[model samples]
Target chain A: MTTMRTETSTGAEEVRPKSALEPLISAENVSYHASGRQILQDISLTVARGETVTVVGPNGAGKTTLLRVLLGLISPTSGRVTSKPHLRIGYLPQKIHIDPVLPLSVNRIMTLTGSFTQEQIQAALEETGVSHLNGQSVFNLSGGEFQRMMLARALLRNPELLVLDEPVQGVDYLGEAELYELIANIRKKYSCSVLMISHDLHVVMSSTDRVICIDQHVCCQGKPQYVCNHTEFQRLFGRQFSESLSVYSHDHDHRHDISGNIQEKNQ
Target chain B: MTLLDDFLWRAIFAGLGIAIVAGPLGCFVVWRRMAYLGDTMSHSSLLGIAMGFLLQINLILAVFVVAALVAILLFLLQRQKQLAADAILGTLAHASLALGVLAISLMTWIRVDLMSFLFGDILSVEISDLYLIYGSGLIVLLVMLKIWKPLLAITANEELARAEGIPSVPLQLIFMLLIALIIALAMKIVGVLLVTALLIIPATAARRFSKTPEQMAVIAVLIGVASVFIGLFTSLEFDTPSGPSIVISIVLFFFLSFILPAPKTYVLR
Candidate 1:
C-alpha cells in the first residue's frame, strides 16, 4: 500500500524512495474487544498531514470505538497505533453533558482543560463565529451554538490534528451543512489534518480526501466517489442507497450568522 | 480562661475549618453527581469507628484507613459490573453500618457513647481536634487547588479529558482518596449520618449565585462559614444538638437561596 512504509534501521536501506508526505497518524491491524465481543477487527488506516479523512459506518458499527482507540482514550485489544512524536491533537467528543447544578460559562468551558489568555479565547470563539457567547451560561446555549462552542474550545489548543466524533449530531439540516462548511474552512485556515466520524451515508463532506466505510471492519476505503461505487459499500448500504449518496460540496454565496439569518458575501 | 481553652471556641474553629475544605470538594460532589458515593463512604465510617476501638488505634487514623479501603473496594466492585452502581453502593453502605453496630454492641467490656458517634457532640470538641482539622483541612485545600483544573476537566467529561492527555484514571483515584480523607476528618464534627449534608447543602445553595466553577466553590465556602456561625450561635442559645443544628442552618440557606432571584444569566433546566 502507498500509505504503508516500513522504517529502515540500517543506513544501507535508507536509499529507498520515501513518500514526500508522512502520515500524522497510522494504525496497523488494529482490533478491539470489549466484554467478550469484538468491536473492531484488523482495521488499518492512515491520516496524512493536511488531509481530511471521514469514517462513515452504520449504528453500532464500532465507529466510536475506532475514534477512541485512535485518540488513545481506549487501547485496542490487538495491533497498534502510531503517531508522530509530540503530536498535538484537539478532540471534540460526541457530546458533553454539563449538569445544570454546576454553573459554567462559555468562558470557563474554553479554559476547562488548560488556561488560555482572554485574547486567545476571543480569537478562537470569533473563528467559530460564536464570539457573542463568551460570557453566556452553557445551559442557555442552543444545540448548534453549543457545538460551535465546543469546536471553538477544541481549536484553542492549536492542534496539529483535529479529531471530531459525530460533529453534526442534534443539529438541523441547515445547521449540519453550515457546520460542515465551517469545518472545511477551519482545515484550510489552520492547515491541520482532520479525522472525523459520521454515521450518515447519504451525505459525505465533499472536502473529505478519503472515506473509510467500516462495519466491524473496513468494508471499503478510497475517495468519496470510489467508495460510493464500490460493491462492498453497496452491500453494506444497499446498492440503491449507495447510488443516491451525494458529496456535500459548499457552493452557496450566502452565509448564516449565529441567529440563522443569511448574509451576503462581501465578494 | 483564654479562647484556646474554651470548648465553644475550639468547636467553632473546628467547624469553620471543616467548612472551608468541604465547600470546594462539595462542588465536585454535586457536579460529578457522586452524592450517593459520599453517602456510602460516610455510612461506612461507623465501621471505621468500631475497628478503631477494637484495635486500640487513633480513631481518626482508623477511620481514614477504613474509609479508604471501602472506597477502593467500591472502585473494584464497580469494575466487576455485577450490579448496578447504586445497588452496589446501597449494599456496601448498609452492610458496613450493620456490621459496625453489631461489633460495637458485642463489646460489653467498653463504655461507648453511641449517640455521640452517631449524632456528633461538636460542643465538646477539644483543642487537639482543632489542630487536626486545620492541618488536614489545609492539606486538602492545597491538594484541591493543585488538581483543580484537571479535576474540573474530568468532571465535565472524562473521555475528553483523557483525549487531551490528562491522566484521568489516576486523577479519579486521587479524587476518591480525597473524599475518603474529608469524610474521615469531618466525622468528628458532623458524625457519620450528617456528614454528606455539610458537603452538599452549601454547594447546592451556592449554585444559584455562581457563573463559573471557581465562583461556585468560593461562594459555597462563604455560605458554609455562614451556616457554621449561625448554627453554633443558635445551638448555644437554644440548647440544641450542634451537628444537626448546623445541617439545619445549611438547609435554611438552601431554601432561602430559592427565594432570591437567580443570577440573571442562569438558565433553569
Candidate 2:
C-alpha cells in the first residue's frame, strides 16, 4: 500500500518547497517488502542539479527498485517520493530492448522517442557516433550499438535528467571507454544530470559528482574518497569488502581479521 | 460497367478504410499477443447487435452500446489482478455471447437478421454503411496519425511514455475506444465470427516484408484491400462465402510472403 498527496509549493511540485535548487528528486524513508520479507529499508536520497550519482551495491541490493521509484515507475511502500513537475527524463533499461514485431528503423525509434526535426536526429546520431546505424533495424543491433542507440534516443529528448541501468555490462573495453567519454561530453554539452547504475566503480567513481553506496538500503553516501574508508562498510560486507578491492570503495586498513569469511582480490 | 463499377468502387473504399485502421491496431494486438482479446471484443459485438433487436433500437447504436460496455467490462475485469487477463476476457466474451444467444432464443415476437451480423453481408451492404465506414475510417486513421508518435511511445513502455509526458493511460483508453468503434463498424462487412482474421492476417503478412512500423502499416492496408477484392472475385466465381474468401486470399498472400524471401521478423508464432 502507498499514499501520494500533493504538497503545496511556489513551483509545480510541493516537494521543492524549500527552494528551487532543492534537488529534483527526493525519496524519504522509502522501503520495499515482498513475500513477507524486506528487500529494502529506510532509503533516503536526493538528486541535485547537474549531478551524476552512481549507486553501487551487491546483487539484489534494490538498485533497480530505487531507480524505478526515482523514475516514477514504481511506488515505494512506506515513504514519500516526489519530483519536479514537467521534468523531462530519459531512461535506458538494462538488457537488449527490441520489439521484434515493431517494424521500425533506428530513425523511427528516434522519432518516437520525442518530436525532433531530421537535422536534430542526424546531429544526435552523429553526437552519439551512431550515424551509420540510422536506417538500421534496432532489432539487429549489437550490445555496444544498442547502448549507443539508447544514448541517441535520450539525447533527442534533451532531458533534464538521464537514468541508465547497467550500460557497460556486456561491452568490451573500447565500447566502455566510448560510452564513458560520451557521457562526459554530453554532460559538458547539455549540463543535464545523470544517475547511472554500475558495478565497475573504478570506471564510474572518478566520473560522477557523488557516490551512493547501497546494500539492503543506502549503506553510506558521500564523495567517492570518503565512503571508501568507512568502518561500517567493512563490518557489514565482511568478505565482499575484500573481494571487491578492484572497486573504488575498499581500503587496505584491515590490520585485524574481523571475519575468516573474507575473500581476497587484487588490490 | 456502371452497375459493376458502383459495387467495385464501394467495395474498394470500404475495404481501404477498414484495412488502414485494422492494420495498425492489429499490430498492437499481435505484439501484445492479444489474439484472444481481439476475438473476445468481436464476439461481444454480436451480443450488442442482439440487444439492439430486443430493445427495438438502431442496430448500429445497439452495437456501439454493447461493444463499448463489454470493452469497458473486459478492461475492468482485466484489472482484477487475480485472474489472468485472457481468462477475464474469455469469461466475459463467452458469457456475453451466450446471453446473446439466449436473448435471441426468447425473442420470438420480433424477427432479426442475425446471419447478416454474424456472417457479414458485405455484398449487400447499403450506401449508408459505405458512409459509416469511410467517415469512421477517416476519423480513426487521422486520429491514429495525430497520435502515432505518442501512441507508440505509450505502447512501447507505459511508464516510459508517462515519464516522457505522453499521458499514456488516457491516450491508451482513447485508442481502445477507437478500436471498439472499428470492430463494431467493420462487423457489418467483415462479420464477427472471423473479423479478427481479417484484422490480423494482412498485418501479419505485411510484417513479414516491411522493415519499419509505418511501412508495415501501409503494406498491411494494401494487403487488406487486395485480399478483399480477390476474395470478392473468387467468391463470385465459386459461389462461396465472402469473409472466408477474403481470409483465404490473405492466407495465399501469407504463403507467398513466406516463399518469397524478405527480411525475417519472427512472425511464426
Leading candidate by lDDT: 1
Clashing pairs in 2: A103-B212, A103-B213
lDDT tens digits, residue span A153-264, model 2: 8888888788888878678888898888888788778878888898876666568777787876787887766665554445544535433542554445443244424445
- Which stretches of model 2 miss by more than 4 angstroms? A1-22, A32-40, A84-86, A172-174, A204-206, A225-267, B1-13, B110-116, B263-269
Interface RMSD of each: 1.2, 3.7
TM-score of chain A of 2: 0.83
Can you write out model 1's per-residue Cα lDDT over A57-77, one digit (the tens) per residue? 878888889988888777788
Residues B1-269 of candidate 1 have per-residue lDDT tens digits of: 48878878888888899899999999999998989999999888888988999999877778888888988998889887568999999999999999989988988888888877877777557777777788888898999999999999889888888888789877877888888888888887778898999999999999989888889999999988998899888888998888898899999999999999986667666
Among these predicted structures, which one has the highest TM-score? 1
Clashing residue pairs, candidate 1?
none
- TM-score, candidate number 1: 0.91
